[model samples]
Target: MGRFNFFVAFIFGFGLYFYFDQSCYSYFHKEASSITKSTASGHILAYLITLIPLLITVLFLKKKEINVLEAVGLSGSLTKGFGFAFLCTLPLLVAFSVKFSLNTGLSLNTIIINTISSAFFEEIIYRAFLFGILYRCTRLGFLPSVFLGSLLFGVAHLYQATDFVEILEVFAITFLGSVFFCWIYAEWNFNLWTAIFLHCLMNLYWLIFNVDDSAIGGMYANIFRFLSFFIAIGITIFYKRRNKISLEVTKTTFCIKPKDR
Candidate 1:
């Protein structure tokens, strides 16, 4: 019953946020820009509206006697999350630095709106709320828990591409990226900051350098990105082995765990 309530609440809250964010964001941004006389402020105000769904989820959690911070994976060690993410994404930083020149025109507004806000808010909504509650609270398996959120995450990036082929590529990449983020989130003891920092640093590096206009980059760009992927996986495996911690996502739990049910 608790899991059912949580699932319904999150879906409803996220649905509401998604609708408003998609349909009304421009209006809110325009209104906010008129008041603050700053486009960045407008963007910030629009992004802050994401908190409505977060607060809604928190209310449901409170009713269930769950600690909101821990449940949402916010109580984890920020230092560890940021540190590991930085180490794992070193390849992207180095590769982009060598291959692409610095984007001199990059502004603070771009960093705040594109990298920081997108990373933080998307992770909280998609990974923590959508995937986390489904998997942890409901005991749904990894594949099932991550599928819907990842699908939406992928679809959300379709705006970057016009043609069908490019759209497919963008969707595939972002969908896999979503799954990877969710995997690390679970592996790191459900600490969402890990995913958040990783997403932010990667996006920041991409934005800082003139890598590619869209998420789908050239062959060289993707090469380094894949290297970073392998590095993250390798490091995670090593860490788990050294600490004797079993992986959270395993074959036995790939689908609904009969025992857990």
Candidate 2:
């Protein structure tokens, strides 16, 4: 629940700042170059909104009052978080098959924008906030959490899309891709950094491939849509099984000697 609290609060802050303060949207409205001076102010201003929430989350984790580190983790847990991110890179490696056109593929500046800023915003909001929150109270089980989290993650992208159909397709792709990322978080008992890196790579891969927008899901698209689903599910099931085994093993080691009531 602490994870959820941190996430929800951050979102509340971001929403208030974005809508009322008019950060990025304001830049666009004014036709300002966000990559440049005046627009940079908006970006900084936007991130500032979540300052409190991010700080609170770190403090809460630092206090050792919750199992957040165990439930999900930080960058410090290299083996669990970083390793998992590396492993998950495989599916994406295969999926992003589109040949890069030197002229067409992403520029270095775009990489920085996409990988650093955009990725940070997306992960902090969807994975950290949505999954971290809902997983706390509802024991409705794992798949359900993945499904719901993915749905929320996808739906949020609607704000950026133009039409209904495109938005829906984006949602579906996001949901599927998100489930795999979420599986890592849950599987390793909540490794947040792994989720973050995997997410960044997922987006980076798509951008590098210069994937046709329509191929995300449309007639004659190159995407092996059905295959990706199966692969994601297969990985998820394997991890879930492995996690259950690890949990059972650890239960014996942490036995309680009852405290004085």
Candidate 3:
């Protein structure tokens, strides 16, 4: 019964997220395209509409202090997690800012709103809710969970993509991004804050400084994106090494028996 409950939770949560996401995206696209003057209004309404799932996710988290920060796992000691996440993203951030710089005129307020909204809803849905429930249900190893979760995350991005080639490219890139995010969340012991931070930085870069392939051709831009992928893998390797060493030291200390105290 317990295991079955987990399965049900995973399906329901994922289905809910997909439903709300597609609905909001479709509505916003239609509104934005149909009326010239409705662009801003459409966007705002869409943002609000997307918040419904987030609200449900928060209620589901069920912590006594139910706030966004707490529900999203941000109310922890972020000193180390923030530093690592920032460093991991710094290279790509610099590359995008220098090479793209397409939408710098976007107001700081708009950037903040989009960053917070996107990071919270998406991270909680994919990483916290879906991944968490799946891991519990399957009891699979970390790599397996990450692969399945990330694959779903990548697939979710296919809704708006019209071109077949573009869909493939988006899925491939987002799959890697999902792997990186799941790794980050695990590194922080399932703290959604770290994932949220890194994700926001990534989207902020693209949203504020969207890639202009004419300026930096597709091949070279892909190279830059791949660099970030390699860095994420490096971080995971480093984390494993560090944890192994810590475990060895702790085992040795345990065997010492306190010097006959």
Candidate 4:
């Protein structure tokens, strides 16, 4: 019954978020603009409306005696999360600095809207609410749990693509990115901050430097991106081993959980 409720909650929450995010964002943005003069504030407020489902889910979990923070992967160490993310993404900072010039005209609004709000909200919505609940709270396995959200995440980035080939490239890269974020989120003991900071720092570097116009980067950009990926994965494994902690996502839990089996 608990798992059933969780699954239902996920469906409802995800649907609500999607509807408002896609359809009602403009309306809320206008309403928010009336209240707050800043466009960034309006965007933030509109994004906040999309989190109604998450708020409701947290309340629902409270009724079930679930630790809301732990369930959503928010109870992890913020410091460790930021520190590890910085180390893992250092390659991007270095590579971009060497290959691309910094944007002298970058604005505070861009930082708030693009990097901070984007990373934080997207992680909570797509990852914590959509993927986390299904994988952690319900009986769904890693693959099944991540598929829909990752697909949606990929599809959401299609706006950046101008042509069919670019569309394909964007979708593939974002989908793979969604999967990588999920893996690290689970591996880091469901500490969402790790993924959040990683996402933020990556976006920050990309925005601060003229790396590429789209998520699908050029060959040189991708080479360093892949290097960052390898560094993150390597460090995760090394720390898990050092701490004698079992990895959360393993072959046994890939398709279905042991209890389900």
Candidate 5:
């Protein structure tokens, strides 16, 4: 990775580490005990901290590399874009009740925050910059690029905790999702926004359905996860066979540059 990219990753890693150490437990405890105190201040700090590297990418590294819009798969049919977005989340909705047995009101905020902050920031860092750099250097095939990129994307989530099991869980799940995101972006010619939108929906479903029991509920969710993962594979293969485009070109988003004015 370039020095700039490495620096950005450092900033993201450190920021999340600090945020979790300082405030996450209190935040969770407050929720469990039914405390009504507003954490707006803390959340703001967390967001600002999280946004540092993302803003840097947006302002600097983005154009130096792939266009931000192209990184996450935006260049495609609108209907297909929306369909992919919704298909990703259909599992979550089907697995769990929309209205909860009890309401925490965390769903809206989770979706909003995750969609914008986590989804956008992560795509820029993990997929756009990371994958873009690797592809630029190696010109590897689609599978190689996505595999390495998604692994890093998921590996970075070890920030949530140092515990081995927790880390493994995060990596397993996040890695799988990162793979899916890579496919989605490929479908949309690396449109980061569409990827972010679909990512938000996918994670939103998980968060909402998992409000009470992520561990146990995860079993059920895993069923859907496996189904969706395989389904994505099928679609990816079908398009590969049907379109006759090289996976390399798809990974590169097939951005066509105009002649000099």
Candidate 6:
């Protein structure tokens, strides 16, 4: 019974943060007919409004031990965790920025607000909440947790596309990106702060690059994506080696198991 309640809360929590937030925000925005498009203030307001229910749900959960700030991966030392995470992600962001050309006309206020809000909310739901639940509550291993979390993350982006090919493209890109995000979280010992910074930089890069426009051709896109993927894989391998943690996935669960140093 207790486990059943926990499962229900977990599902509800995901729905509240992941599924409902954007839907509610869109509905209210349309009904009010005040904001024609997403402004900085509007984005902030929507995020805050949606955040309320998630926070409430967290409060009601049986395991209050899940420290959100830490789950967001901010718990580690600033120098080691935050700085390292930022520098590690910097190259990819820089490359993307150069490739896409910055949109100077885009408001800095909007960029900053959206980056923080998005990093906070998305990481909270995907990494901190969903992945955390699987990591902590279930017998699943790290890899499996990441795969499932990333899978859901990919699915959540489907609404952005109507075409089948575009949908597949979006899912593939997002799923790979989520895997990278999960790797960061794991590399930092499941600290969400590490993942959050990476996520923020990625979002900022996309925003600046004008994601609506495909600035590069297929060959270039594939090259860039593969390069980024390799970088993530390399980093994960290095982190595990340096920490003396084994990346042995269990056969039964196909989960990531990090043997401690």
Q: Which structure among the candidates has the greatest TM-score?
A: 4
What digit string (tens of lDDT, one per residue) describes model 1 on residues 124-226?
Answer: 8789877887788765799999999999899989999979999999999999999999999999999989999999999999999999899999999898887
Model 3 TM-score relative to the real fold:
0.67
| TM-score winner between candidates 1 and 4 | 4
- The residue pairs found clashing in candidate 5 are 70-190, 71-190, 72-190, 72-191, 72-192, 73-190, 73-191, 74-191
In model 1, state the lDDT of residue 113: 84
Q: Write the per-residue lDDT of candidate 5 for residues 90-177, one digit (tens) a residue.
A: 7656766644343455644455555555675677656665565444433355566667668877767667645788778878878877
Number of the candidate with higher TM-score, 4 or 5: 4
Model 2 regions lying over 4 Å from their true place: 1-51, 54-64, 67-72, 94-105, 137-149, 159-162, 214-261
CA-lDDT, candidates in order: 0.86, 0.53, 0.63, 0.86, 0.57, 0.65
Give the runs in model 5 whose Cα sits over 4 Å from its true position: 1-79, 98-103, 136-138, 159-162, 211-217, 239-261
Question: For candidate 3, what's the RMSD?
Answer: 7.8
Per the 3 Å backbone cut-off, how many clashing residue pairs does candidate 5 have? Answer: 8
How high is the lDDT of residue 166 in model 1? Answer: 98
TM-score of each: 0.91, 0.62, 0.67, 0.93, 0.61, 0.74
By TM-score, how accurate is candidate 5? 0.61
Model 4 C-alpha RMSD to native: 2.0
- Model 4 error, position 13 (Å): 2.5
Ten contiguous residues minimizing lDDT sum, candidate 1: 57-66
Tens digits of per-residue lDDT for model 4, 195-245? 999999999999999888899999998898888889999999999999999
Per-residue lDDT of 40 in model 5: 42
Per-residue lDDT over 1-261 for candidate 2, one digit per residue giving the tens place of the 0 to 100 score: 455765565456545543543444454423444545454444545554544454345444332445544423454465565465556565555655544332365566566566656666666555654555445433334554456557867776666567887777777777766776665565555656766776666566656665554325343232444444455446656776876644311222223212331
